[model samples]
Target chain A: MGNAFKEESTELAKKTAPADLMIVAKGLTKKYDDFTAVDGIDFQVKRGESFGLLGPNGAGKSTTMKMIGATSLRTGGELTILGKDPNKQGPEIRAHLGVVPQTDNHDNDLKAWENLYIYGRYFGLGRKFLKKKVEELLDFAQLQDKRDVKVDQLSGGMKRRLTIARGLVNEPEILMLDEPTTGLDPQARHILWDRLFRLKEEGVTLVITTHYMDEAEQLCDRLIVMDKGKIMAEGAPADLIKKYSSKEVLEVRFGSSKNAEAAEKLKHLGDRIETLPDRILFYAEDGEKVLKQIHKLGFEPATSLVRRSSLEDVFLRLTGRTLVE
Target chain B: MSLINASIDSAIAIAERRSGKFGAEFYAGRTNAILERAFLAFKTSSWMIVLSGFVEPVFYLLSFGFGLGALIGGVTDGAGNSVSYAAYIAPALLATSAMNGAIYDSTWNVFFKMHFGKLYQTMLATSLGTLDVALGEIGWALLRGLAYAMGFMVIMAPLGLIPSWWGILAIPGAVLVAFGFASIGMGITSYLKNFQQMNWVNFFMLPMFLFSGTFYPLSIYPDWLRMIIEALPLWQAIQLERDLTLGTVGWSTLAHVAYFAVMIVGGLYFTTKRLSALFLR
Candidate 1:
């Protein structure tokens, strides 16, 4: 009977086999008591792809990452990782996946190197392998100088870098990072991006969740923009911007007093105008032409500039709210 | 038949490699990994914290041995033989010390690792499962209990409190008692919502320490009250230590072992069940 069942599963695997698909989820949902965190959503991630889940704080990006990380069980969905069902084979699937959670969960009392060493031990790696790996990881994280420092004593960015380095102790097939640079300074963010970019160049599959649109654009090969537990759009950053927003955005600011009134006067100047408290944005294929046309309409802005569109513009257009919370 | 055997052998090999199938060595290796982490942490901590376990019980030994022993000359044993008050309370103190050491290690240490340290979260991210975590933590608690029990035994032997060479057997007995309490204590610690609710730990522990035949014989209490005390698992630990130190091995020893065996099983069940609920959900 077991052999027959195994044969049936192998048949199913052959049928559903994607192009080196690393993760696949369909109708994925997570409900907590009466509240649903991740509503039914569908997506696939190919091998070696850097995939991003972009959303605000409660938009279920983290929830989806947890499912793909094989840590949290999905409430309702068909989710598979490396061709193993996440529900039945969590430990098996997790063997090849490395997860850096949103919060750094380092063993605070241990030294940075010790943290990496112990985490490697959990994968049942040999001591001889770990010694060389720890040195390499410390150098990779640029934490060689701080290897002896206790984890809690490191700066926020150093802690994050160490956490990322610790995740690589297993030399995993895929690395999942949730908000990898959320609390970092600009310099720290750039350093981490460099580190992550290097990891990608090594052909490690990445699954990242981020509210920072630029981080999404910088790290993700393709992304899904989520709002209220549902995916609003999914595409490459540039493709998403082109599909949802225009080529450029014209930002025109009036005095705070006339900002609301200025938006009304500027309504017909572009394809769409979104008015904020202090500025009005004109979404148009040619932002310079829109600015010129606004001047012809006897509407002079205190200051104005034309800039190319971004993923942020696309998110704002779809969600009717800002991405960062 | 050879073809079938070859296919079956290949299938088992695939299953073992793919599943990271845990044998005895797998569990021992992973749990030792966790203890190795503890060892790393201990290297950085002050020696005072490590010594504090031995110090507290020794203080109780001196204060009670001299103060209360002077006040009450001697007391009757469980089998109705008169023994010095110092000797009477010494064996029971080992039990209570074991309880205290295991309780603190399992509850406070485990909770801190769970919520504050996020250590278990990081461990779970690896190939380790809920059972690995439970056993690993219990294993650490046993190490701590062993150290404290051995330290107390060192003090007890020098004071002429041991009535028999069989009293030497109490070292392992104290560790067994510690294992029971540590497992059960970890089970309760898993349910705690926050640190402030830790008063409940003290609440459960203080009464058990006092009433579990630790300070006095159960015969002094009414039969109904004695029955209730007997139901508590700590009382069995005290009985085991008391019998072992006095060299009075009897059939009831198995009953004491059974009490703790039930606790070990039950506590491990709850520890894994509750932790899986908290973490894997």
Candidate 2:
């Protein structure tokens, strides 16, 4: 824990001095009638960086994204995008920002090409300019063959891609996506990720909010873990894994009811332990050593395995709940 | 006075400043784009549905003004005198048609786009403000109203309904009437939480249609009831059409114009305010 903390703080110190920043939030808070949705959280996003907000469903990630998108006003605190106050300069700032909301809100009544053209028109683009731009966007979204197709006829993945294409109509500098692959199949998720990867390569700054740990691990350069509207930790995925979780975890099942009993005895064998309905987990530097210890203690399990730690383990350690449960 | 002025100021600020750099031309184009979007998306079958709307009021005009005209004789006018049955009810049918076309587009269509289609949210994500949406949608409603008004006029001559050259103004007059109904209808829809709440629209519309002097004279109702019904925008619509088709132009025409002007401005103002509260929160 000490060495991991040292590594994370040093990494944070380096990132704090980023040369160019596209977004900055200071003590940002959002309050509703009964409770706080975002509790004075702080973060910074540098230019051309792939940043993430990782948390459970009600972690205020969407609320924070709304504030940064300049659509929802901040109840308190300050937010700046492209070096302008979002509250006072929402339109000016949003002119350079692209937002893919949690759901695809594309114009379902229009054809694919018409959706792109009309969305670009909202930015006051000329018909001649949009004629060329729409073709380019249709090609970019891989919908050139489906240009005249109505939006309701497209598959879920195609709808998402068209929506992303519409977001890029203005050639925005910062692209913010909320749960970009929430409902997609595995293959479609990969294709969308590839598209996002290409956008990052093109020097577009990306701000993403997702609950998928592998998504955070694969895409984000830096992320802040949030729970109950507050920051739990902040670092790169690997750094967060090293800081909040052990190097490995051992899983053993002693059926259902006895798993808790086994956990009572197995608690002393590892650095930390977590128990579930069907399995017991031992967090340790060496998973093999923990398994051996469990065997030596004369505990027979239904099944046992040893694996390396992942962001899931870190999430569990920090929030005490699985990411997808 | 200041409140209306302030809302107008903020609304204009959203239109001119928040919409972008191209100024008035850009604003016009964006609003037109929404109408254009609908145009591009409409299928032949949908056009059939729009054409069918024109047929309904004609049926009413035929049933009430032509078929029942002999039995009903002349209707009592505001001045307590009998007027031609066909002429008296022609203006009423015109007013109801405008009301139906405008309210249908603004309420059911707007609700569908807002809740199910998720269309406005997407547009609002861009530089489009509440004003662009308001004007664009109401503009489309007015276009429909214009078509109906013209068709109503062409048919009015055959029915022995046209009485004066001032009847030409009813073309623009239909637009004004639609603007008032459509704007207020959209304002009410923005506050709605679900489809069930839409029944209130029917509740208000049914009474306004029946009692706004669209059919019988206001003399059937008591004095207090007439006063209440007279203040409604549809009543003003009916009265304006009656005066124009009768060639009874007078100074009070300006007062009728002012009533609808207030309705148009006030309805549009509340629409923008309510939309901002709904989408920009």
Candidate 3:
């Protein structure tokens, strides 16, 4: 199935030489009165790739998403979705793109199936085609039994799944999701991730925006880290981690009063060290070796932990702040 | 099922073709699809609300048209002809019913959908444009206005309030009033921010209904006051319906029709502009 989907994409790609580039933006900017929400940024998304925008709240991730979604016009710069200008050809561009917004906006008055069915009708799909498509999407979202239920009766995860299904009713070429898993429980988040991963495998291009570093690492093939409406770094998760962070990290807590004093003593042991209110962080090639060196220097910590470097460390190194507050 | 599919398919093809000719940014020509969604939602809507809209004008007809008209014998219409007090007010009530139905859907229902339901946000995210959304919603409200007008006429015909067969034309006249009110009401709703602001719609509507020559002819008032009431949209609607049902069609009837024509065009223009400003910006 994956090969078949890829082959279809290749056939489509032959129609235009640079057609594989699904989205392109240059010096993109958005402004609301005096506030510049999205300061000039540049990025490109290719066909069949999972691209992401990673940032903290109010970092202009959603603002950028809205511009690409063609609902919000950019205040400056150029954007082309599927080789069509969003400002002039929004309906044409939107017809071929699927959007799953941050918050679920399903019609509470409509039943689960009707939500999907009515959405397809908005795309000018015939009732017969939608009748069959709605069933297929219900099965895919794993909400077959809940088809007749009102939207309010469904659980949070169920509603999210249904929203995702409704976005697919038009069989769009690119699917854009804004904060897809922000409010879900751990298990629910995992299930939603699995579903998204399957779409990626089936060769559907995905554009996602998220504040969660773990989610960005799990889902994005390549991502741009944004801070205060600017791109801090852009790369694959592991490459970003390797370039901006050490191989491992050692975390030690010595109560609030003693942490600052301990960080002063352990500064020379690791490649770098940071002191917080109640803990200290040691960036090193090997965490265990760093711990042993700390002990040899006659520093006994109250509590200690060692872990591998992740995208969080990369974000910290780039922006001098964490991805999530 | 296949036959339904075929017809829908042709309808979509027509809309797409129209969109291509007109440019695809502001209008996709898919207003009918929006109307279809409303019908689907209406299947589950509470019937009491709809029945109540139809019942309000009937009660007014009973109390003011019958009960009060018995005390007051005859009233002078615009044509210098004396009409029964009940017959004079019956056409005005029909005009008021159309306005009420249109206002209810476009203001309260549209306000909820805009702020609470986030419905227009969802629709605009699709291939649908702001014009399509505006037209579809106003079209639905106009349909309800049509329903209310027809229901009131059914009650009026049995009571001998409709004296001439020309009264059938009043149904279309009521629809025009609805189109005018519904379009402008939806546009005004986009500017409102809260339920408190929305109450002002009702506040303004009550005075217009009472003073628009509904209970009596405008000549009873002083000249300046009569001019103010005549300038209102409901008064023009009442004038049009009165001319038709009273068999008094003349040059002034054309003037009344022209007033609503301006309303329909101006309202649709304002509605489309406001919807785009609010959602597509």
Calculate the i-RMS of every candidate, to one decimal place: 9.2, 15.3, 9.0
Identify the CAPRI category of the predicted complex in candidate 3.
Answer: acceptable
Candidate 3 lDDT, B1-281, residue by residue in tens: 11122233442343345433454677887898899989989999999999999999889888998899999989987768888989999899889889989999999999999998999989988888888998999999888888888888888888888888889999999999899999899999999999999999999999999999899877789999988888999999998898888888899889999998999899988998898888777
In the range A14-81, model 3's lDDT, one tens digit per residue, is 44327789888889999999999999999989998999999999899999988888899999987777
In model 2, residue pairs whose N, Cα or C atoms come closer than 3 Å (at least 3 residues apart or on different chains), thus clashing, are none
Candidate 1 Cα errors over 4 Å, as ranges: A1-12, B1-29
The residue ranges of model 3 lying beyond 4 angstroms of the native Cα positions read: A1-17, B1-20
| Each model's total of backbone clashes | 0, 0, 0
Ranking by DockQ: 3, 1, 2
Put down candidate 2 lDDT per residue, A67-176, tens digits, no spaces.
88777878998677655555544555666777899998877777899888888777666678678778888888899999988888999999999988888877777889
Looking at the true structure's interface, with contacts defined as alpha carbon pairs within 8 Å between chains A and B, what fraction does model 1 recover?
0.50
**Residue range with the least summed lDDT across 10 consecutive positions in model 3 chain A:** A8-17
Candidate 1 global lDDT: 0.83
Q: Model 2, B16-118: lDDT tens per residue?
A: 3533233321133358867777776665237677887788888888888878988988876655556778889888788888988999999999999888987
Collision pairs in model 3? none
> In model 1, which residue pairs have backbone atoms overlapping below 3 Å?
none
lDDT for position A210 in model 1: 93
